[model samples]
Target chain A: MSIASILFAALFYLAAITLAGGLAYRIADYARTPAPLKIPTTPAPTTTGGVVFRMAREVFLFESLFKSNLWIWLFSILFHFGLALVLLRHLRYFTEPVWSWVVLLQPFGTYAAFPMVIGLAGLWARRFLVERIRYISTPSDHLMLALLLAIGLSGLSMKWLVHTDVVALKTFFLGLMRFDVEPLPASGLLYLHLGLVATLMLIFPFSKLLHAPGVFFSPSRNQVDNPREKRHLAPWAAEMEK
Target chain B: MAAEITAPAYRVIPIVPALKPDAMEGVKPFVASEKIQDALGFPGTLPDDWHERAIAKMGELLKKYRSLKVYLDACVHCGACTDKCHYFIGTQDPKNMPVARQDLLRSVYRRYFTLPGKLFPKLVGARDLTKEVLDEWYSYYHQCSECRRCSVFCPYGIDTAEITMAARDILDAVGYGQKYSNEIIGKVHTIGNNLGLPGPALENTMEGLEEDVKEDTGIDVRFPIDVQGAEVLLITPSADFFAEPHIDSLIGYAKVFHAAGVSWTLSSMSSEAANFGLFIGNYEQMRKVALRIRQAALDLGVKRIIVGECGHAWRVAYSFWNTLAGIGAGADDPYALMLQKQLDQRHKQPTHICEYTWDLIQRDALKFDKTKNDHLVITFHDSCNVARASRMGDEPGGQFDIPRNIIRAVANNFVDMDENTIREKTFCCGGGGGLLTDDLLDLRVKGALPRMEALQAVVDSHGVNYLAAICAICKTQFSKTLPYYGFNMRMIGGVHQLVSNAIILENKQ
Candidate 1:
């Protein structure tokens, strides 16, 4: 294996472990911490089944964002949906036979990068243009946008602008999965794209990106509006009664 | 109401105001006195190690409350909630924006807790919990009404109210508690209400109310106090016994009970339903304040506990009362189960007065002469807590509908304010979440600009003369701020006040 392959392989392992383990630890922390009060934003669903539907709508549709601002919602859905397709399409690199759906989704996923880049641009522009959004934006916020934009551009460049040996890249990724390092494509754009993706994975658990899993645990969104019917007592609060 | 503090002019289109950086700098609520702090079990004064203590308190809260932890972590600063805050829109202060306000604490939270913030503080907008930062937290967090309006629009459900509450809790933990909330909480602990009216004083107020009602309507409507074995226990805000328009709603509750023919009594032990502990965001203190209501229900042997018209009071009674004091059902705890068993299961435990009145109106049990309110074309102001934090009837969004229903039944001519200013999207009356104190008068008047603009629109288009509300704070806030906007202070009154004006007392007729 080449030094480039070995370095890339090690970095990917570290990134994957950090992403999964960090998310697990953070998610468990959120799950264990009790929501001492019933704080569902009202007009909320009362039943458990209703709460499930509400959360589904929130996650799948960004329902609150849609209700808030059409501009943010449009860009958010575009980037998120585009990223979803691209990630799913990339499954062809890992699977031995390249799943039938992944094979079929290749064309659509190639086009998805456009919307993904466009969405990120709109979101980043808001950070500079909108006074309220700009006031709240920190260096990390702007940098996060820059990083995502770079990843998207580099990935697109490799795909269309500067074509790399994709068959070798796929073999290198599949080898990494099986702990058998292989030679990587000699492409600067490919390395940059992979490196950025690794960085994003590493930071996912620590940054506001935790919002991905945090939404699932948000008491305001996840909780049922049945405080009158059922009592919710945290362990610490319950000790007060004892 | 201050001479120098000018109210913002009403907008023809109700546009969100432009950012005015530091527009409200140095605008902080009064610091709690040592005695008031001690009354709420906080330190008598700012401790020497306040910075460390505040950080410690934030860490403790992060572990205890999921809302605090998740909210602190989840905010993406999307600015969806930027134009959403009434204070931000009214004051034009970027710091009043929900995201900016939350960052006052989030910055410290990051510096102390998160890895990126510890490693690259400026990059992530994290800072040390310095005296300056704490002072900033104090100024901005109090400006928030804890209304949860921004939470409605957040993509991740990042509630600024939860963050503000957590920030206040940390502030109080380090002897930085606001005077208005801390003092009122102290009053609730000692005198059983925000007004600090003693039992005899409350009795006198009720007696005076009874005499006035009898003289006005030629009917003897008894405002019974501490009556044992009453079927219903009415726990209302002490403002009802003191403040104008609020007292009218107090009489309205009595009139509703008399018309419904229910045996109800007010308990001196828990005469107040407004829980300032909630305002201060101290869970233990909140629970302690709620426990009095439970004790009163048990002591008076009342089967039902119905709340009076107060915004945060109704929120606590409806949402937190069960968890805090066992005022609702399905509790595994013995005390909670005991209280639950004693409360009449047929009706909602600790119901809102509007809910009770609306149920009666629905059943045709109460008669209203709508013509009595013909002189007034009225609009309803959905109190922040009632609009976004609590429910009324069994149906969702019932809190908004129930009050309007009561108004429509009592008054023939009723028009709603702008749709955006009503229901779940309602703006706060500016003097809520313990900012109702006189010290915050300037912030209160200015923060009410959005609501005043919406009201002005209806007044111009629909000739709305009266602004009806269910929450005591809304009535009080609007009554004080209405005159500043070229309207009569008397134009604002409670939903129940309308019921009082038009309600037909069978005994009188």
Candidate 2:
């Protein structure tokens, strides 16, 4: 294997571990922290089933954002859904004899890159165009958007602009999954795409991207509105009783 | 100061105003004095090591409350909640925006707590917690009403109220507490109520109310206090005993109990339902204040505990009372189980007065003379805390529907304000979350802009002559700010007051 293959292999391993282990630690932190009171925004679900439905609407439908702004909701849905498809399509590399669904999703996911890029552009444009959004945005906000946009554009370039050896690239990724080493494709564009994806995974736990897991733990969205029926006692709060 | 302030014009639709940076920078509530701080178990004054204390407090809170840690990290600055704040609409201040208001604390939280902020503070907009940043937290956090309107719109449910509460909690820990909330909390701790109304004085006010009701309706509606062995214990804000429209609601509660023939009494121990401890965001203090109700419940041996019309009060009672004081069921703790067994469980452990009245109205237990309120064309202003924070009855959105149901039953003409400004999207009374002090009157007048504009639309189209609210703070805030916008302060009244106007007594001559 070339030095580049060895370096990329090590980088991917580190990124993967960071993504998995970091998320595990952060998620454990959230779960362990006690929500002392039931503070679901009113008109919230009374039952566990109802709360599941509420969360489903919020997660899948962007229910609250849809209520807030049409433009933001449209762009957010485009970016998130398109990214989901693209990520799913990328799964073909890891599975030998790729799943039938992955085979079916190949064409649609390739096209999804356009909407993903367009959505990121619209969201990034608002950071400059909208005054309130501009005021609240930091350098990191702009960079996060730029990073995603760069990743999408580079990934697309490999397919349409500068074609790379997909079979060899898949072998390299599949090799990374196991202990065996394989030669990486010499395309800088492929390296750029992989590098950005690795960066996103590395930062996922520490950054605002924690919202992915944070939403599931949010008391206002996830809690059942049954404070009157059940007593929610935190360990620390309960300790005060003794 | 009053002469210098001008209320925003009434717009048909509340247009998000142009950003005015630092417009409300000078507005800050008076700092709590040593006596008040000590009474509430906070530092007597701003400690010498306040910066360290504040940071330590934030760390402590992050572990204690999931809402704080999640919210501080979850915000991606989507700007969904930017125009959602009434203070932003009213003052046109960028800092008043919910996301920006949260960043006042979140920026500091990021700086000290997170790795990226420590490595590259400028990139993430994190800043060291300086005196200037602390001052900003004091000014802007007080401006928020803790209404949770922004939370209704946030994709992640990033409640600025939770952040505000945490910021205020940290502020108190460093001995930099706001006078209004801290003093009120002190009063609740020492005097058993926010107003410090003595038991004898409360009895005097009740006697005056009884006489007035007798004169008007020729019925002896009793306002009993400290009566043990009653079927229900009524815990209401002290404002009900002293303030207009609020006092009228007091009379209304009395008439309802009189007509229903349910035995009820108020307790001096927990005379105040409005918990300022909630405003300061101190769990210990909030729980301390709430324990009075449990003590009252035990002493009075009341079968039911029903709270009167006060928004945050009802929220504390409805949402947090069970957790804080064990007023609700499904607990194994000795204290919670003890109170749970003592109180009647057939009804909601602590029911809102609106829920109580609506249940009676639905069962055809209460009679009403709708014509009594026919003279006034009415619209209900859903109090922010009650609308967004608490629920009533068994169904969801019961808080919104129950009050409107009671209004339609009592009043012949009823109209609602703009759909955007009512229900879960309700605007603050501009004076909620301890911003009602005289020092913050300018901020109050400015923050009332969106709500006042919404009321103006109804008045223009539906000829709304009276704006009824179900919160003591909303009633009091509107009564003060209405005249500034060329509306009569008398236009502000309570839902129960409307019920009082129309409620017919069986024994009245």
Candidate 3:
């Protein structure tokens, strides 16, 4: 395999794994904290069908997203969906022959990548423009967005602009999948993209993005609101009071 | 002219025999004893299954979900929540500690759900769900009024109220509920009222109220119960029928309706506005309790239902009524349709009782006869349920202006408590969430101290004779807890009383 191709493939895989591992650790740490969840009670059992509907609404419609500032919602939806689709398309690199459908949809994938760049830009602008959003946005938020944008732009450049040797790239990935180490390729842009993607994944679990799963576990949403007729006593309390 | 005999000069004689001296004396002692017991602490006993069921339920719920399991798993044991709680602030007891309070549920949660808890329980502060643990939860969770104040300050936003509520629900499911809560729920289910005062009692009370209005103001204001075709069904807590402050508030609503010449009726079926289901964590019961008001409105064909000045009731009414009643279904529920129609028709929006009362007093320029309320030197206590959860921040329920307006109307010596005592920052009465029973008296007293302290500030400065509160539970708590704390203040009549007292008597000849 060409040195440049091997370098690019190795960088991407390393970045993704490193990011995912870091995010998982951060999420575990956050889960340990005693954050207050003070959602008002409703007399509906969260598990009783309503919860499924609510979950669906949140996932598909982004119900709370819709309720949030409209511009931010638009940017978030585009960026998230775009990022997800691009990741799926990248699966061709690991496969034996470039997946036929992915090959056919190369143009569409490129088109989708464009929105990832635009959406990230819009979101970054919004953080600077809006008061409350800006107030809450930490330095890490801006850095994360910048990294993702750089990753998307670089990937787009590699696919459309550079047109690097495909056969060499494929051979390099196959070697990596087989645990064969190859020498570095001289694609500075590919290395930059890989680094950005790695950083984003590393930061994911520590950020508010962990709310993706945390919302389900939130006591405000999960707990049933039937307090008028029931008596609740904690065992520890019972002992201490006694 | 000076010697003219006035109408056949009959000798002065009593037309009817007076009560026997012994009988009259006997009636006084009977009344005095009942009053004394009510005023003093009367310790009541819980049922035999109360403790067992509570523990079992707590264990069962802890076993039900991994989310709760995770929550129990997640506690870092920060005591930051302690000072944030109004109850703990009011009461200096170590048990009032928030972490200590949450440990009531968390320890059992840990013992039953976590791996470390199951294998090496002592390592993680985890203990088995014993009867002692259940009793502690009941005591501490009950101490929490579920006001959500601590949650606001919690950095991670760990809501102990949710824990307490979850524990309460598990306890209720297991039949370890409080008597007052259960009995009230039963009454709400059976007779459609919390007090179990059936249709006859409701009618009798309304009729008596009519007579009192006639005798006092010569206005002959008719309190129509179960009157069909009324535009509004005014639902109030049962305490309004018998409780002092609430009764006055009831009269104020009647006066507003009378003055507005609006068609309204009181539902004998769903008389009570306070729903303990909200406190106990029973959704079905909460729905059933709320359903009564909607049913009454539907049965009577009223366009809208107006809930009275009860805190949780308004919260339930505003937040859950439409969802629970299946309102907005295409012709399946006429209540929702009628409510929509009423909303569309009204020039003024339908509002909380507070807003309505306040608006009327402002609109009419109603001058209160200070002499009528001379007995009261008043300060207001804002119920937490109303001040925080309900729409008190912006529009102040329908009667937002009512409490302040009413106090000013009735008492010549009206006094303001601390700045935070009235609006958004008001402390909870601590007896909300069905904690008004004798079993929770200590917690209730402690919880009420912040509020009591605020009131005391006003009382000391203004010599306040009465603490005006709108919620029935708040009234009950304050009425019981005030004297215990050496605050000689009584619950002045609700805002409605001021309206009834101050409104111009139309029949004044």
Model 1, docking class: high
For candidate 1, what is the lDDT?
A: 0.90
- Sort by DockQ, top down from the best: 2, 1, 3
DockQ of every model listed? 0.88, 0.89, 0.03
Alpha-carbon lDDT, every model: 0.90, 0.91, 0.59
Residue-wise lDDT of candidate 2 within B99-170, one digit each (tens)? 999998999989999999999999999999889888889888989989899999999999899999999999
Worst 10 residues of 1 chain B by lDDT: B1-10
Residue B464 lDDT in model 3?
79
Q: After superposition, how far is residue A76 of candidate 3 from its true place, in Å?
A: 28
lDDT of 3 by residue, B291-410 (tens): 777667668887656778787776666545544443222222343455444442342223466666566666764445678777667777766666555453133242244567666755
TM-score of 3: 0.61
**Model 2 residue B185 CA deviation in Å:** 1.1
lDDT of 1 by residue, B1-509 (tens): 34587788766667667789998898888899999898888997888998778878888999999998999999888778888999998889999999899889888889999999999999999998888888888898889999999999998888888888888898889988899888888888888888888999989988999999999998878899999999989988888998998999999999999999988999987889889888888898999999999999889889999999889999999999999999998887787888888888998997888888999999999998999989999998888898889998888899988888888888888898888888999999999988987888899998899888898889999999999888888888888988889999999988888899998997832
